[model samples]
Target: MTPRPGVREYVRLIALGRPPVGWRTTDVTTWSLARLAGRLIDRLVVPRMSRGTLRRILREGKVS
Candidate 1:
């Protein structure tokens, strides 16, 4: 099975999707890192991400 990207990776890519360059990071503290992780799983990295094993990949601390 393949792996998924992390929160920092997600944020980095999504941020990279934007222009001007300086608006890369965010301060969204309302959401836990896990929730951000889940969002990165479900939204950005799913379907093309292989299987439905985001939680396992995350717990394993490995990202493709």
Candidate 2:
């Protein structure tokens, strides 16, 4: 699977004043400080989910 871009990349893309093609913003206040913190949490959770999925696949011979 392709790696998802991290929060830093997302910030840089927004800083450029143009979100990359296909970008979607779920939060209404994309530039808010709160959004940054929320994204940080999201970044942390995503890796754990990926690792869990990988472990499941390896141990069970298929992802659950």
Candidate 3:
């Protein structure tokens, strides 16, 4: 099982000079660290992501 690339990972990729894949500029612009943390909690509780997706993100260090 892997985890999906969450908001923080997406943001990190962008910060690393990578282009946006499935995310919008507003999505990154509007997110604060606090909001990202909250969303992480939500994902943990709600289980919206599959483990494979997250594993890919971890292994690749970017969203594909």
| RMSD of each predicted structure | 8.3, 13.8, 9.1
lDDT of each: 0.43, 0.38, 0.44
Deviation in Å, model 1, residue 27 alpha carbon? 17
Two-way TM-score contest, 1 vs 2, winner: 1
Q: How many residue pairs clash in each candidate?
A: 0, 0, 6
Clash count, predicted structure 3: 6
Candidate 2 segments whose C-alpha is farther than 4 A from its true place: 1-30, 45-64
Candidate 3 per-residue lDDT, tens place, 1-64, comes to 3333475465345334532344433435444334433444554633454444434444466433
Provide the lowest-lDDT 10-residue window in model 2.
55-64
lDDT of 1: 0.43
Better of 1 and 3 by lDDT: 3
Candidate number achieving the greatest lDDT relative to the actual structure: 3
Winning model by TM-score: 3
Per-residue CA lDDT of candidate 1, range 1-64, in tens? 4543464355445433333222233644243344444555657564343223444444454432
Residue 8 shift from truth in candidate 1, angstroms: 4.9
Evaluated at residue 56, the lDDT of candidate 1 is 49
